[model samples]
Target: MSQEKPPVPSGRRRGGLLPNARDIKAWEEGGGRGLRGFLRRTIRAYLRWNRALLLDPWIRYRPAVQLLEGQTGDLQRTLDVGSGENGLARFLGREVVGVDLDFPATVRWSNHPATLLRAIRATATALPFRDGAFDTVVSMDMIEHLPTGERPKALREMLRVARRTAIVGFPYGRRSREFDRSALAVERDRGIELGWRQEHVLRGTPGEEFHDEIIRTVGAVRPEMTLSWFGHEGMRGLRLRWRLQFLISKDSRLYGLVFFPLYRLHSRGRPKHGYRRIYVFKKAAGGKPGDRVRRPARNSVRDPD
Candidate 1:
């Protein structure tokens, strides 16, 4: 039987920032043939179990909690822009309304019961909320999915609605390129070996460009808005893990036994290049409601991670 193409969201021709319906459909249809298919499914299940058991709680959730420590201000009400399955609402422990183009259906297969309860369907460029509606706004791993030109608009909208602060995090600099390269390599190798190709559609924006645009956008809102930046995760270590994770997932049970410990040890350390960059913007003191701040001529100094 021929595979049916996944339907795109109404009024939108292409997929959103993250993996969309089409990507999920492709993944579902791309299991290997005969013995290969059975082995692939078995391995995938083990990997999924590992991710749910260890990776999510330790690698992702813990880091996010650590990143937000001493950073979140006035968490009374918050907005999570481009929130996918694992919404920030889970972490904040306060009122956090999540908005995304995909929202409740972003994950495709499984329902995010908790996230759906508070998530609304909306786009980052045009958030459906009143000015200063949220005390703090947070967006993670979402901005780079947009075209370079649209990122500023999204950042501006986040700032416009934030009464006190806005926090944004994304892969940065050489790290972004390395991720894309490793991902593409894995996909290419999989297609050659299993006759299933997974296409990555989004373009990556350099940290420098993203950083500059963010600075300009925030400055335009409140020229005196204090911007603090934090960088984390060594770039080389991240690249190595990305490659190893893909290779190990093929025979997860056997390789995982060996890979897991080395993965933990290798992931430790500081490097000259950072994989992720987090930006926190605070409204300037004595700034009125509608003040327009001019963009600074040079980039600001970096803060410790």
Candidate 2:
């Protein structure tokens, strides 16, 4: 079977400052004195702020946010399990309750206000909410953080709390395994380790075996809900991004200088083969995984590399 391409959101125009330097320069090219200059700076500040929150973590996970925010729509009561220091709630721009083990002590200096605003001290394996407490539940790039035995448990907790939809994303399947292993080797050679990638090394990304297991679990336990999945960020894309990561690693001060432009260069693209898979399990009002849920609005983007 052929894998599907990444789904684009409906009515998304993606307006803001353009990613290139010439555009930025043109925008700044006038009115240096008086109120107009002040206005220019203010607008620049606002645009920068938006870019920071939305385009940041731009390398690996921006797609997850774009996908989640688009599909969930205007839901108010969403839960993000394993929400980490800065969860999807920050980008979703709504009232989402975030639960994580270490959120309480996470520093607020670099965090957006939304990250800490509704964050709770809890675990994905044991969510505190009653059944159907949220309209949507999302756990992105976090499932692999758990041990093999606990991955399903975390997923179950998300499903248990979600009244309508539960979205889970992780680095899994065969291609993802190869991607991370190569990334680890490249990072190790530089003697610089990305903390999260190290965990991916230790815990190991799941492959086809666990894939079948999850399908069986959902099929047997939540027959009313439906499951669908697709892959994103193929090997070529992953390698290019991984190499870019090393360009600024040796100097903390130079990271932003080098990263921002490359970030713009690599902001959004179609993946040919998905190194990571996103599994969306949605529940219809009175049906199972066999029931049809609205699919995300899709465009003719290429399949993962």
Per-residue lDDT tens digits for candidate 1, residues 1-305, read: 99999876454357455333454334445597797476557555755654443432133333444545565446557788876656665554444688887744444213234432367888899999998898778887777777777888898898889888787876677555656666666666766432211211246644676666776777667565777665546666656766676666633444555556655664454333566566777777776433433323343454222
Give the per-residue lDDT of model 2 (tens digit) for 1-305. Answer: 99997653233334543234443444455447677577567556644554454234343455555655555444567887877656665556555677878755653524455343477888788999999898778777887888889987887777788877777777776677777787788778878667888888889887766777777777766678877776555666556756775554523333455556655665456443466667777775567345433233462232222
CA error at residue 190 for candidate 2, angstroms: 1.6
**Residue 52, model 2: Cα distance from true site in angstroms:** 4.2
Every model's TM-score: 0.63, 0.70
Candidate 1 backbone collisions, by pair: 223-293
Cα-based lDDT at residue 72, candidate 1: 48
**What is the alpha-carbon lDDT of model 1 when measured against the actual structure?**
0.62
Q: Could you tell me how far off, in angstroms, the CA of residue 229 lies in candidate 2 after the best superposition?
A: 0.7
